[model samples]
Target: MDIVGDSGATGYGVVDPHNGWVAKMRLAMPNTRINNYAHDGAMVSDFLPGGRWPDTTDAVRRIGVDQPSLVFIELGGNEYYIDRDPAQYKANLETLTQNIWQVSPRSTIVYETIWPFDPRQSTSMHSWDEYGAAMQQLAVEYSAGWIDLRQFFPPHYADDTYTHLLNTDQIHPTDAGNVVEYTAVLNIINRC
Candidate 1:
């Protein structure tokens, strides 16, 4: 298995002690080796055509060489934060998945829906609801598996108190939250 995304998949060194979702997934499937190529602050454009970000594009190329059995992608939150056009976001996502297929045709592509951001920490011109819907449609069009984290984390935080699902920053998940993400990925991999 391979993981590609922004801080959510990378843990941004803040929750690294708990290990990211890829590490947890490796522990769950001890026989499997998971490669994580998630870069903090990466957006959908980073993986698109003419994108200058080498880390993401390099990872995609490495996938061709590594040829893992599965690849999980969790990105686009930054695109929303940067106020990218929804139509362009959709196109970039399509291009990304197509690039994945071109590199590792045998690998099963699993597209993770962007998690709902904590409104208190970040503001977005494009709503999480819009991103979620786009992800679902893209997953279907690309014939990839979909892991909707919204099923585990609510779209909005509670007004009364904090939750273990998200960290103090509310943008990233706490250690326990990573466990939730791990479990979700495990379920999807099993089904696949």
Candidate 2:
């Protein structure tokens, strides 16, 4: 399996086995090899042609070459932080899906929704719901799998006292939160 996107997919376990979702996934599938192309604070543009850090060794290129049986993508949150237009984000996502298919047509591509951000800390104007809807639609359009993180970690802006799943930063998830996400992915894989 190969994962590409931002911090949520790459952060915890890429180096430290105790913290990342990828590490936990390895535990779930001990015999499986996992390659992670996720980067911290990466946006949709980062994966596009001629963008910042564009190279043949980028995630898309790796996907093309590795052709992993399964690929998981968790991006778009940074797009909201940068106030990127939703239409542009959708187009980038579509292009990404097409690229993945062109490279590995048989690989299962699972697009994970961006988890909700802390409303108080964010200055961006985009809506998470709208982004999620666009992603869901993309999943259908490309005949890919969709993993809605919101189902397990609902955003609670009104009551800060509520037992939120997010970390103190309110942008990233706690260790347990990562487990929730990994479990969801496992469930989706099992169904398939």
Count of backbone clashes, every candidate in sequence: 0, 2
Candidate 2 local lDDT, 55-171, one digit each (tens): 423778788888899989898888876778788889888888888878888888899996777544366667878788889999998788999998777675646653345677777
Model 1 over residues 6-72: C-alpha lDDT tens digits? Answer: 8888865345655667677777788887788888888877766566578777888888888999988
TM-score of each: 0.89, 0.88
Residue pairs whose backbone atoms clash in candidate 1: none
In model 2, which range of ten residues has the least summed lDDT? 10-19
CA lDDT of each prediction against the hidden true structure = 0.78, 0.78
